[model samples]
Target: MRCSCCQKELINSLTLQELFFSSSQRCYHCEQLFSKIDQAQVCPGCGRPNSTELCQDCCLWQQELGFVMRNFSLFSYNEGFRQWIETYKFMGDYRTRGAFVLELTEALQKYQEYLICPLPLSKERFEQRGFNQVRGCLDLTKRSYELLLKRSELAPQSEKSREERLQMKQPFELNVPIEKIRNQKVLLVDDVYTTGRTLFHGAELLYKSGAETVKSLTFAR
Candidate 1:
């Protein structure tokens, strides 16, 4: 195998334990670079790796939005992870999906009972990208829905400041009826959680539609 980010050859003798249990497709160095969020040290709300009792973003979210969301992220949005995202999601290197399948699948298993939903892309973005980045990361057993639709093209969230992201108009619309999702627990899946703007927007719509609980899971934060 080779490192997903560096494209360097990986050499190792597989142990019995690794053959049986390990699902890593990347080399040791590349794998180590993609830092996993330590569950014990994460913020209660956003799941970011933090030493603080409550991360400033989460605290601000609670104060201004009057609610807090529980989000679980697998990896930090570091340079390595960002490049991997660029390749898989933007460059359309579909084979890169294999690198994350096992990890993403395991993370999503706990949310199986909830209504799993992938964050939608605008029609233009979908045409440009040729696939939904969130959906590509998921395994087939994990069912998802097109519950939300991107109403129109907007500025790339990456280009915006935190305040701009938080204040951006709601971009998602419900394709499913409130009656269908009423009292349902929703798990919104996405490729990345930057300022939590997109996920919160989806959550707000779900809440307005009477969802019992709204949470999010992302590949990176």
Candidate 2:
């Protein structure tokens, strides 16, 4: 096998349990390039590492929105993560989606009862990128998901300043029937969580549409 990130030949060094149960696709060296977040030490609201309680950003969200978000993130948005995203998302290297399949699959087990919903890309963005980055990762997990939201064309989040992101208007509209969301739990999936604006907007819409609960998961924070 070859490492998904570096394309180097992989060495078979897994223990029996790992060999049987693990679905990791990257070599040790490539994997080590990214930093993992310790769930226990993270902020209760947004999963910011080393935080004991809600981070300031999350507290602000609660003050403004009347609810706090429960987000789980696996990796820190460090240099390695930025590089990976640059290649996988901006460079349109679709195959890099496999690099985190094992991590995503394991993390999602806890939300098995919740409907998985990957954030939608605007039509223009999807055409330019050729795929929805969040959905690309979710697809490799072989899990079912719903395209329950449609996005309007807008500036990409990556290009927006923190103030701009926070001020941005809601860009998502429900793409499915209200009955589909009513009384259901939803797990919103995204490639990254920046200022909490985008996810909060989606959550607000779901809550107003009668969703029982809404949580979010992102590969990076």
Candidate 3:
């Protein structure tokens, strides 16, 4: 397979071990540039790499919201990872989805009891993009649903600064019945978790709808 980032032919073809243990979507060079969060040195709240304590943002979340969100992030948002997102999400390179499917599939298996929900894009954005970037990356064998809906149009979160993003009002609504998700653990899936504002908003709604717990899983943070 070709490298997802550079589009170069992979020098080492996928091995049985690689197919089983690692995501061989990108070549060695590209793969090395994208670092996974070290399980040991991560923030308990956000899962950011190399943090021994709850990051300041999450501490604030606990203070203001009275609870800390438990989030799992798969990768650090490094330069190479940014390029991967640009290609897959902005440029709409569908093939890039294959690179992370194995990884996501493996991660999601642990949350089998939770209802999986992808963060919804605004109607205009969905029409323009043709697919949800978060959903595109998932290769789930079990059932899932597009349960969240955008409450209204808004500027893309990526376009906003940290402060601006935090100030943005609630942007999502539940399309599914409250009864369906009531008392269920809900997993909010997104392509990236920047400031945690978006996911927190999602979690708040889920909680109000009677969810037992709300957590997020992002491809990157």
What TM-score goes with each of the models? Answer: 0.83, 0.88, 0.83
lDDT of each: 0.78, 0.88, 0.80
**lDDT over C-alpha atoms for residue 126 of model 2:** 89
Worst 10 residues of 3 by lDDT: 139-148
Best by TM-score: 2
Worst 10 residues of 2 by lDDT: 18-27
State in Å the error of residue 33, model 2.
2.1
Clashing pairs for predicted structure model 2, backbone only: none
Candidate 1 residue-wise lDDT, 31-132, digit = tens: 765778787888878888875377899889889777788999999899988878777787898767756666777877888678888888888888898987
The segments of candidate 3 whose C-alpha lies over 4 angstroms from its true place after superposition are 1-25, 140-143, 153-168
> What is the full ranking by TM-score, best candidate first?
2, 3, 1
lDDT of 2 by residue, 7-34 (tens): 7787777678876665566788768757
Output the worst ten-in-a-row residue range by lDDT, candidate 1. Answer: 140-149
How close is each model in CA RMSD to the real structure?
A: 5.1, 4.6, 5.1
Q: How far does residue 47 in candidate 2 sit from its true spot (Å)? A: 0.6
What shift in Å separates residue 157 of candidate 3 from its native position after superposition?
18
Q: Write the per-residue lDDT of candidate 3 for residues 1-221, one digit (tens) a residue.
A: 67755677876667778766765467777677677888788899998888979999999999988778899998889897898888878998877765666567778888888888888888778888888888776643344655654555568899999997876677777788778878999889988889998899999888888989988899898
